[model samples]
Structure formats: C-alpha cells, structure tokens
Target: MRNRLNRRVAAAASAGIGMTLLLAACGADAIESGGDASGGSDGGVDTSAGIDCAPYEEFGEIDGTTVSLYTSILAPEDQPYIDAFAPFTECTGVTVNYEGSAEFEAQLLVRVQGGNPPDIALFPQPGLLQTIVRDTGSVVPAPDAVEAAVDEFYGPDWKQYGTVDDEFYAAPNSANVKSFVWYSPSAFEEAGYEVPETWDDMLALSDQIVADNPGGEVKPWCAGIGSGDATGWTATDWMEDVMLRTAGADVYDQWVNHEIPFNDPAVATALETVGGILKNEDYVNGGIGGVQSIASTTFQDGGLPVLDGSCFMHRQASFYAANWPEGTEVAEDGDVFAFYLPPIEESAGEPILGAGEFVGAFADRPEVQAFQLYMTSSDFINLRAQGGQFIPPHSELDTANLTNPIDTLSAELLTSEDTTFRFDASDLMPGAVGAGSFWTEMTAWIAEDKADAEVLDAIEASWPQ
Candidate 1:
C-alpha cells in the first residue's frame, strides 16, 4: 500500500503537477504565515544571503545502483518522501528502499556493527547522528558541498543541531518549533483572558484561570506524557524550554554538549518548576496523576476539548495544529498561532524548543549528494508547499503555496521577533540520558512522588562520562 501510494505520487510529480497540487486535491490545506502573500517579513529568511553549492563538483554515478534508507516516518506522512525520491530515482537511476524510523535505527545498529550499513539513513534525533558518528565511523564528514547546501536552504543555526566537534553529520529535513504554546482564541475570549506576553504574565494568567475555576474542571493546561516508546518526550520539551530561559543560551549549550551534568542545579531547578505546575491542582486538565498516566493519544486528542472550552492551552510542537477538531476553522486565513513559552522570570531572552527532521548520508556517492541537495532546495520547498506534505525550513521558500494554518504558523514562528530557537534538550543530550533515563525519571517523579533529589541524582548518574 505504501509503495503504491509512493508510485502514484511519483507518477503525478513526473507528470509535472508537483506534490503541492496533490496535497490540495486531497483536501489538505497548505498553511501560510500571516495569511498575507508577503509571507511574514519580521524575521524571515533574508533573500540576500547567498549559499553557493558549486564547490564540490558533481560526480558521475553508476546506473542501476540502489540506496537503502531507514526512517521512523509513518507511511501517510512519508508519502511525500516516497513521491519526491521517485524523481531522483528517475534522474539518477538509484532506487531507494525506505523503512520505518524505529526499525531503521535498530537494524542500522546491527548492520553497522556487522559492516553492512545503508547508503543513507534518516535519523529523527541529533543524538542518533552523534551515535553514528562516534560508533560506525562510516558516516562521511559533512562535505563542504553539504554545508553550502545547508546554508543555501536553511539559516545559519539550521545545521547546528547535527554538528559535532565543528563538523556536521546530517542534513535537516523536517522541523517543528517547540517553543510554542497552543490555545484557542475562542476559549481565551470566553474566559475573558488575554494572551500573556512575558513568562510571569503567563504564570499569572494560569493562576487566574485556576482561581476562577476552583475544581480540576476548566483547567488552564493539557499535558500528556504517553507516547509508547517515546513517552516522556513531551515533558522533556517543557523542561528544556524552561531550562533554556532560566539558564540562558550559554548554560543550555553546555548541557546540550555534555559540558555540564544533566542534574546540574539549573536542570534540577527546571524539573522542579515543571513538577510544581504538574502538582498544581488547577493548572493541568486532569491534575498531576491525570497527566502522568494519560495516554499520548489521549493527550493529543485532548486539544479538541481545549477548543471545546474544556482546557485553555496546550504546550506542544507546531505539528499539533493538524490534530485540531475536524470542523474547527483554524482562522479563515489559514494561520495557526502559538504563544512563545513565556520566560520563567524576567529573563533577557525568550527560549524556544527547536524540533525538526534532518537528513544524513552513509555513502558519499554523487547521486546521493545531488538528491540531498535537491530535496533541501527551493525546488523541493515549492513542491512540498504545493503538496501539503511538509513545511519549509528555508524562510525564502514561496509560502504563497501554503494554506494549512499549522504549517503557516510554524513558518511564521521560525522568523518571529524576540524568539530564540534552540534544539530540544533531550535531543542534544546523550541518547541513554535523553531518551531512556530522563523519561523514566521524570515519569516517576510525576506519578510516583519520587524525591526531587532522587530524580536529580538519577539524571546526574546517567550523564555520559
């Protein structure tokens, strides 16, 4: 079924309609920034920035060769890549066999250890890229050509997440702004509340909402830590955003680079702060325990209730906009807006969670490089915008083609003023600490009343030497 969908999308692209048309025809709206054709000029990509990819001369390719790709992308969401890659295959005759992201990672580990890795791998987290670079020694140092390609397609900070020891290990493919706080305008108006600008303002607003409601009903926040294998990632985002604002970019960078311990005072304080919110009787929709055990699927579905006036706000990635109630009109102009997670205090900068997809190559073949460059280029952005399968990472991409409110708002926040975007803390942390111990410890802290000190100790113990 997945292969058939890919072939159909490919056939359409080959016929020259592009993916954007396919998306619209399928009834998926391409969200655009600000609802205006101008495409949010505030902090958007500066068209003057020049990134030249002419340095690494294109290499000749051997026909009939195949490149195997492993990814965690679901079939429906991955249709775009399948469709997009079909063109590359036709142009270079290099067939691509893609697999699920989770299965890909597990299999890739075995293959690398056994000396038979794929030509390219699409890792979801930067931590995985770090692991591959440190373990297999098969990943080629991101060449000058790739670096130039990144600069051309994305902003300067774009490639920072995948960089290790001043060398890049992957190409950024999909990105979700994490610093956003989603809320229904109708709910806010019904509650007679205004969007808070600063962190204190947001807290004060939460307090007001709780005070007015009294019981656990009509809560101000909706939190779910229930993704099956990746359960605690949502909680991690909340902690990371707060930490970034509390500790400042310098300290946050240290934590990400493993220069400081994960249980450092700064990180601990951040956890305690989030815990306080979870513990608050009126803050979260179902209270601490309710949130702790709530299935991630339920948590995602909880957004509709917020729109129905059951909760006031949700802190999630920009992607959640897609899950809005079926009939809920996301602003007639197709703009989905999210508040920047207010500063924890009167901080100098507003911290945001940067989450997105990245592309990496295991083989240094010319065809591979060409496909990488092309996929991340303006051409692909235009194609994706038309298809509604992706949101553009490059600010310069023609957003006029986008109509989905979530996609449009995500692009808007990418270049919004006073916003400081940083990668998710866990993604930057060592995998064991980020994906394993952190989730387990945080969940335990929330549901089991684990000692704060004990939680801190557990996280500290998990830090890589």
Candidate 2:
C-alpha cells in the first residue's frame, strides 16, 4: 500500500510538509508479515523495546505515522535493516513500511513516473537518483536535519555523491568494497602458490595455473555476469576496476562523465586489459563451463569453483562471503578468503573501487524526514554494521561494530590514506548507458565474442545526447 494520506507529488515536492504521509490508506504494511499497519491507536505507542524516547521526542506528534522504504536489498540481507528499525519505531511511533524487490532497478522508474513512488528509496546507484531528480522533479531534497548529519558523519566525497545541481538530496547509507579477489589460503598453500600483489603478479599466476593444468581442466579464474534484469553488471564491475588501474582516476572520471567517449583509446585499452582475463579462454569460467557460459552463470555462483578445486581464484566484491555455503569457513587461515585485487603498478597508493547505497526520500513529511535523518546518524551506522554484510560509511563507526575480517579489511581500505577510493563509475554515469547499454554490450562482448571496439562504440553511442 502506498499511503500518501491526501498529499500528491505536487505537495511532496514543496519545502513545507505536514503529516500527510501514509495513514489513511487501508492496506497491509509491506514489512509486517501479518495485520493492518495502523501503527498505533490514539494515546498509546509501541514501547516493547523499552528504548528511551527522549531522542525521538523532538519530532513532535508523529505518533502513528508510516513511511514506506523500498529497495533492491532482499531477504536475509534485508533482515538487518528490519531489525535495526525496531528500536527506531519503538522509540518514535513511526512505523516503517519496508519492501525489498529483485526488480527494484528496473521498476523504480515506472513507479516514480506513475505517481506512486515509495516514501524513501535506497538507491544502489547515484546516477538513477540524478535521472529521477532531473527528469521527474518529484524527489524531495533532504531535510535540514539529514543534511546536518551528513555534514557531521560523512566525508566530503560522500556528501558530493548525494548532492546534484548544488542541491543535497540523499545521504550515504551502506557500502561494499569491490576490489577483492576471493581465494582459498589452504589451497594456495597446498599448491605452493602465493597471493599476488600486483597486476603482473596476478597474470603470472594465471599463466602458471594454465601451464599446470595443461589440458585446461581448471582455469585460473571464475566469473559470471548473470543478474536478472540487471544482467552484465559484474562485467561492468570488471571494466570499472581495470579502467581505474589502467587509465588512472582522472581518466576514469572523464570516461564516466563523458568528457571522453566510452570508445576512447584509454577506455578501449581498459577493456582489453579486462578482456585479457575475462575473454581469454585459458583464464575464466572455471568449474562452471566455457567462457560463453559466463553470460548465463549467476554472479552469486561465479566464485564457487575455488572451493571445489576447479578454480583457484574468484574476483568479486567483499560481499561474496554471503555466497559461501553454511559450513564454509571464511578467514585468512580458514577454508576460504579474499585479497585486494592488486594494484597495476607499484605506487604510494592503490585504487579502491567500491559501491554504496544512498538514502533518497520522495516525501518531505516529518515522519519521512525523521527516518531519513535517523539513517544518517552514527547510531544507525553502528546498528547496521552489526548486520554482517554492511560496511557503514560513517567515519565514526566503531571498529568493534565490524563483524567480519572481510568487512574490517574493506573499512580499512575505505579509510586508509594509502588507498585512493572511488565509487563505481557505472553507478555515477547516466542510466541509459550505465544501467542499460553498458550492461548489454559487455554481456555480448563476453558471450557473443563481440570485438572490444564494437562493445565500446556501442556503449558510447548509447550515452545520452
């Protein structure tokens, strides 16, 4: 149920907003397993958690208000958010109606254009936020409180990602490190191989693996690009990682912003660099199938071959730990683990490629703003970090909140002065190409064996004119 009370997009776009959010609409709350989400009746609130309401008392009488949150984060992974919201709701009588969908990236626009967007959206990509803001003019700017929290807790670059056209609209929420290559330490020890620290070293290892195999029974790496509706994103991740290493940060920015064409020599060279492993028959699709099978293989299963001895490495994000089987231990000296996808050249700093979710609000209702503000605070950051898969964006996040070694490593790289951090370029580019042509062309390049230049040219041509 989309509860707007009587407020439409026109009113929500304005600066002044009242309690006209979702209360009058009669329907089941998305987050609740059962029962009508009327929040609470008059003169009462849910105090089951026994949280001090002092912090929430400033929001005025928002006692039975509901704010709907919609995002791509799904079950199991979505549980932490729900768990964290309990304290907030217990303290402030604002019930949060949460919905997670696999089709969020594809269907968000339809909802926005159809005048039924959720009260708040967890945007995986900043580009889509910009697109909706510029095209529809329906997204409300962040409240003063939310903006203040961003200024206090987040870095300047994180703030910049949420601001568009000089207006701050969203705040950084969750983050993940993508510059990781998952592997098994014991397997390496048994095979007498060591972790690679540079691009050249990684390649040498790949070559040695192929030579060792001789018959190509197991390749050096395993990869996949298959994500429903958002297929080929993994390949784009590879492209972004390679582009960062080869073209340098400045060139990567130029390419993402379209200062240089997607087919520019620098970008094409990056593609070639990525292809050296992704396209090379001796390098990828280990344990799964041939290189072409990459198109159909789910990204979740991309790195699984490392466990079965069919492959030695799986290049993926830190979140890949979630894909490991229940009993599979993930540690430096345990059954499986990951290392940074080494720098291309020995330098003072290595580039870190990461992605994060931005909390963008569609309604300016007090309850909506309250939830938005809460999301940006250090309190939420700490609670969210406990959820395991999350890498909170706050500089103030306690190290004790980091639940795993991989997340600790990610937080270290994210905050380390010796590393240069950049958000995923595809997430910052316009959606037509970033989420559209870029994904399709990369899939074709891998599965269809399309020429690198053709893939580049096609993606460049699809950029918004």
- Per-model clash counts, in order, read 18, 0
lDDT of each: 0.60, 0.76
Model 2 lDDT tens row, 92-133 = 778888787656777888999998999999888889889889
Per-residue lDDT of model 1, residues 130-168, tens digit only: 877886677876666667877766666667766866888
TM-score (all chains, Cα) for each model: 0.76, 0.87
Candidate 2 Cα misplacement greater than 4 A, ranges? 1-52, 346-349
Which runs in model 1 stand beyond 4 Å of their true positions?
1-66, 89-95, 102-111, 114-118, 142-148, 211-215, 286-289, 295-299, 325-327, 332-337, 364-367, 387-392
Q: What is the lDDT of residue 313 in candidate 1?
A: 74
Clashing residue pairs, backbone N/CA/C < 3 A, model 2: none
Residue 314 of model 2, lDDT score? 90
Evaluate model 2: give its TM-score: 0.87
